[model samples]
Target: MSGKRSIFEEVGETTPRREAPQGGMIDKGRGRARSAIRLWLMVLFALVALMIAVGGLTRLTDSGLSITEWKPLTGALPPLTTADWEAEFALYQAIPEFQVQNSWMQLEDFKAIYWWEWGHRQLGRVIGLVWAVGFLAFLALRKIPAGWTGRLVFIGALGGVQGAVGWWMVSSGLTGTMTDVASYRLATHLGLAFVILGFIAWYIFLLGREERELMQARRGKEAKLFGLATGWLHFAFLQILIGALVAGIDAGRSYTDWPLMGGQVLPPSIWLADLGWRNFFENPGLVQFIHRITGYLLLAFGIMVWMRGRRSANSATGAAFTAAFVALCGQVVLGIATVLYGAPWQVAIVHQVLAVLLWVLILRARFLSLYPLPQSIRRA
Candidate 1:
């Protein structure tokens, strides 16, 4: 039996209170490498962005078909000796791109284009290696957070598929009269690239904070706003694919006019009787027309999403959507400039890079909508 103690006396010794657990409350159950994983993803993000820029340059310079062969392991090392280069050049000379389009290219000229394609492939290999090493190390050490292993592996699987699709795209031009990869194939390749980038970006956002915080924040998610952003993202993706078609066929330079095509509501030769529906992808005027109209529609929808985003109680979420809309506006300006200037490599690459920026921005906005972060009433 225990004697009763005064209200504030040493009753603590008589009856023990359950103490809270030690260690970090926020990261209690999460893995220790959350920050490390985030850093790795950011590195991949930069590499992929660089890959896109280099790829755009390769296309603009008409250098994509230079290598004329796919050698995943052997191709990693570019030609080291003159004899090796000569053998490589011989292979390129046999392709339709060299025969019909670049027949005048000497060995030195071939070297220029070869370097671009080789560099693109090498960068891809480096990305694959980096991903493999980081992922395996995390998984082996059990450093990956619970429920994240499959998501990480999914990224690697997509990377492998991208490699195979890339080869398929290259093979299309090797035997045919086509000087460039088929336009639809190019669109597919580009669409997949953006998809990969989106996944990396979404994962990065999720990893920025601890798992507990994300769950807490999810309770306050703005559902309607999220729905709007989802629609906006899908619309933007469609526009991107259409834009790829325009680039694939050099349609951007076909008209070089805005608000009208060939000084008319529609391009004079907008339809190809023989190609029929294929005209949408193969015909330059029709493709650009669709790209422009899609741009207008995307902008309009973005504005609607942004307006709804304004109602979010969370300041950070609203700000993210505002940033996305600003990017969309700037991208429109760049698009107009790209057409006005005939899609020069300088302006065109910038346009392409801006598209990447806008894409990330939209994704960030979407993430914030799904995980509304509470903010201080006063500035921090």
Candidate 2:
């Protein structure tokens, strides 16, 4: 028989509680926390989409250079009083864009363009604030999942750099003979925007499922299919950049015919510009020609990828690529229509939105190729 004689004696040996793992190894129990982060990222993703739409509208309306200053803090407030409006208009008037192109505009006309630019910049500010608050809160609370801190931080950093790049793009038209920003600069700005969007989308996909699920799904990875889809993604991105260049120089408005430029296979004097190299950037004929060729190539490559994706054992993965291919065809049709219609603001904006949609779809297909979802087979 056992006897507990002393009241002050310890009853048993105490054990220390195990602490949760950190530094890139997430605790599997943190599913709820991961979901929260994904939701936050989704919010940011939507805002960025809006920002891109507004940006497209701003360019179409020729309002990008309306705001002559980059006040990251104070610029949030629009011109309130008449005097403020006049001051802002005066600043714009000092710029080459106004002096050369919009010289006929009055204060009221300036106000219309100013509001477009102001709204675009304001949306950007909101995005930055949202990122800052969310990131800091998660960091302070130590709720960020392992290996995600740096990825999230990188997005914020890109945003800050993008702000600087925006100013840089604007400054290009403020002086010199340029009535608009350089086409290459515009492409850089837009390219970075898509890059940020792509990262956010990829992160959302990764976080949608549990870590264990992703790891398990990786076992049946379609290595060849993933490689092909990745190549397709890169090609699509390149096409987007080419499209940006087209928009920047108003190249789409140069020819109003599909499958032909000025009723010919290729427009005359494609390389007759003073600077042979500059023709690729400044010559509407050459730029649009390049864009068209690239589009055809992208379509062909996408079809190849889709064919491979159709063989995916996972139905969901197969369906994703199918959807992506459908979107691509629709986008091509929209693009052709836009060109034929002289790239009107309404049609052009729709084209841009479709491009974004297509991009996300391709990314989804590529992702599944990397991490396929498991499906249970039913017994006969």
Winner by TM-score: 1
Once fitted onto the true fold, the runs of candidate 2 whose alpha carbons sit more than 4 angstroms away are 1-26, 376-380
How many clashes (backbone atoms < 3 Å, residues ≥3 apart in a chain or on different chains) does model 2 have?
Answer: 0
Score residue 353 of candidate 2 by CA lDDT. Answer: 95
lDDT digits (tens) for residues 141-228 of candidate 2:
8889889999999999999998998899888988989999988998999888998999999999999988878888999888999999
Which segments of candidate 1 are over 4 A away from where they belong?
1-17, 21-26, 29-31, 376-380
CA-lDDT, candidates in order: 0.88, 0.91
* lDDT of the structure predicted as candidate 2: 0.91
Whole-structure CA lDDT of model 1: 0.88
Worst lDDT window (10 residues) for model 2?
21-30
Please write out the lDDT profile of model 1 over residues 1-380, one tens digit for every residue: 26855677765566878898874476765555998888988988888888888888888888888988789998898899999999999999999888898899999999999999999889989889989999999888888887789989998898899888888988888996888988888889888889989999999999998777789889888889999999999998999899889999999999988777789998998898999989988999899999999999999999999999876778888888999999999999999999999999899999899999999999998998898785622254
Model 2 residue 279 lDDT score: 90
